[model samples]
Target: MLKKLYGKLEISINALESWMKERKNLAGLLVGIVILGGLIGCAIWLNQPVEGEVPTSASQMAYEKASVTAVLEDGAVPDYEDAEGRRVGTQELEIRILTGTHKGEIMSLTNYMSALFNVDVEKGDQIIVRIMTDEDGSYYASLFNYNRGIVLGVFVLIFFILLAVLGGKKGLGALLGLLFTLASIWFVLIPCLIRGIPAIAATVGIVAVTAAGALVLLNGFSLKTLCSVLGCVIGVVAAGGIAALVGNITPMNGFNMPEAENLLLYGADKGMKISGLLVCGVLISALGAVMDVALGIASSIWELHEQNPSLPGRALFRSGMHIGRDAMGTMANTLILAFAGSSLNMLILVQTYDIPFIQLINTDYICIEIIQSVAGALGILLTVPIVAFISARLMARGKRVS
Candidate 1:
């Protein structure tokens, strides 16, 4: 009787333990859902357009979709070699409006084609048309561009399908995290900058928020996620600081950027802080890579400690550093090569013109590219040690306490 009672007690205890574990997991899932839902609601609220913000001229114009019904005329213009030796011509087409206020209206429009801005279309091709209203209530329509929205939509769908199929539950978590990051940028960061918030501070705040949220969503609430979040924020801020210091020393700033003039003209009245835009850009660009390095090191260190709870903090630290060093080479090269690839056209131009090395290096465009690449790489370098040290200390302490 005593032995049978003991066995029954053991089974009951095991069942209780299993139940507690399931309850804990369910609680975590509930918390995650709440946080994610709140974030989405906030994003939607912040994305609403402000009333009376549209200019008068822009309010009088509309874009509508149309399909080419017939090609009424197509002829090349003579002596138009100015288009880089490419054919310059014009096309007259009859189009039927497919959407907006003029849906089902048939009209004849002139479509211009050139080497730089060509939209050669055939019959049955869908395109975008810009319509303008005059004071007398008359309207004019012109060919704007080809309608590629369906193609883009389909491509994005394919990407989501592949991500879900390959990654399973983890992939779904990653997809949610990605959407959160984009929402924070578009709904929070850009709006704050446009509303005259200090660019550097706003960008850094967004970087931290997005990093923390993404890591939490990806790994759930854990010491590893916390360490990675801290490491990523520090590394990205360090990169931005380095870029800002270089910009000040070289007397280069957003004003030297190609789009600065246009931004000034459009955003001056809106109180935009253009000076810090360059540093803001660097912080955002470096964030993904920094987060990757930090999480990788932290996760590795945590796994090491889990496998051998007897390992000392120093041993875990050393193991993390070794892993980080292996990652550094490829990550640094990745940043530099990305920058170079984006500027391939400019590099080709310099080579074609046989630009002197001194002149080439001194150009603002070239200097900006170099600073971006180097600063981002330096951030990754710093993240390695930060993540290693933090992960080691935390994992070791957890083991000791347990």
Candidate 2:
């Protein structure tokens, strides 16, 4: 039994050593470690509490934690139509403060359920309450979001479990890459933007980092991964350039984007560039598709090279180009369909309004979607040849070395 266990361990170690024998693999491993470390650092930084005031002179205002003691069966659920003609309900509840200056105090609160913003509460439920004191010493408490940490935790656990079961080690790597990307967005990119960093520059930097991490994790430290990274970067740059050109040539400004007005209003004091941010948004949206195309083409070419190791660089490049052309058709349709799906509701609304084709096409939303789809498709097309050439050249060089 001892001999068998030792033999298996030796085999595993040997396999691992063989896998890391290549310098490229060692470098990729080091880069992955650095990215993961950066992600952890960002997580620690973002975990710190961020506090801000509402810029009010009211002295007695406070946010408190509370627990619902009772549902107040006497509460009336008045039937009413909201601005959207949708019916909503309201409920009153009795709650006891769990924390803050009002700890142990009982209060009657109203819960308004709207089609847009609402949360249901039950007995013993924990919630956040915003307590505001009037000039006359009277105080009121408003119900905020309930404590949904457990739900979120459960959702995340399920996701990881599914990923692990389906993907094994590869899935774990993908998860790590995903976490790193998200951390970069939430910690690095957003903070930089908030600090008045140029939106285009910050976005491009983050996109490049994300692409590198994802490609390396997915494809490992090989010529394929290198080719994918190069292709993805070029595709992202192309997409960003196209988006900028379109935004500049067209009358569409940042205001045409959803949440643009809100961002502008909030960041007015910070002087955030809403237009550049809008272009950044388009660039980010198209990046995923571009990366997908790049990796697919790179992997396909790498496999071709592996199968025909004797093939010259020119033959490999030609084969890659042929494969890329075939992939371009489906990938372009995929990008268009994805964009179209997201704008389906808006399209339906436009059709319902009986808008003319010319006018409909001229709409800001429609035009933005069109630009995103076209730019992403163009990026994919561009990435194919770039990846093919790079992968073929690298593979041929490696073959000669071997």
Candidate 3:
């Protein structure tokens, strides 16, 4: 009985040793995650309270407040309106400040006949208000945007907890992936962009770093991972080239991005290919899905070969194509739908104008988005065949050697 017990003990010890060897990197990842979580906690603490008072020379500022009552167009309406209409035709809000040095301030404001949006503002509603200083030396309300920091914080904390408790060591690897992605963006990609590196180049650099980091963490030096990496790089180059070509021919002006337009106006104060930037934008945006498709196809083929080591390379290639076809079909639609969802507002605008099919598709935004979607689709399309072909040869090398 003692010998049997000892034998069991030895087996358990060996298993534990083997597990530790595999998970040693995971321990380091957890320590890093804890450190990162602490840093994020510090950042959240710093953003709280959001500057006690809006500084002077402030173009606009908003704050949350409550009010006693509100009125609209010849009626003393209830503080809260169940079916609030538009802000128009001399509608006014009657409000009382709930907090701050301006507590108990009353305001009768014009609603300006604007349709009340999804998040409505009304008297007694805890709402944000833009501070406005009139020529008469008095401050008043202008506009408001919602404050959602607290909600966002709660969501983020819950997600982190989910990762830690549910995933344990694997969660730690995920956290490392997050850090890796962020660092690649901030250190490598952003710096490249700052140096005026071509956006495609910067983005490809970032994606390469991302692919390497993820593959190493998950698959180490395995042939599957290496093949996937090579396949992803090739796909990205092709995708970027396609995007650039399509974007150059498209009518979308360089100043299309609201934020980018403003930044360009500030940065150059003059001649910059706001349009060339658009080309880069399209390329960078689609590169991610391209990499994902490459990895998926390559890894699938590699795993198939691992499972059936007796299979020849040609057979494995065929099997990978089968997998790739199924993946490519859904993935192409998914990519297109993802882009469509983002441009739903643009589509709505086009519908509002009753634009003809030719005109609608010809629109710069539509054209630009098409280029992005097509580039991504083409890249994904190409990656499957490439990864399969490469992984097949590499996997076959093993069989030949054996």
Best by TM-score: 1
TM-score, candidate 2, is 0.78
Which stretches of model 1 miss by more than 4 angstroms?
Answer: 1-60, 76-87, 400-402
> All models: lDDT?
0.87, 0.79, 0.66
In angstroms, the error of model 3 at 65 is: 9.7
Please give the lDDT score for candidate 2: 0.79
**Tens digit of per-residue lDDT, candidate 2, span 138-224:** 888898888776788999999998997799988887787777677778877776676567889988988988889877776567667
Q: Model 3, poorest ten-residue lDDT window?
A: 266-275
Candidate 2: where is the Cα deviation over 4 Å?
1-24, 27-67, 74-89, 96-105, 114-129, 133-139, 145-149, 400-402
Question: Model 3 lDDT vs. the true structure?
Answer: 0.66
> How far out, in Å, is residue 120 in model 3?
3.4
Write down the RMSD of candidate 1 (Cα, Å): 3.2
| TM-score of each predicted structure versus truth | 0.89, 0.78, 0.66
User: Could you report the Cα RMSD, in angstroms, for every candidate shown?
Assistant: 3.2, 6.2, 7.5
- What shift in Å separates residue 328 of candidate 1 from its native position after superposition? 1.0
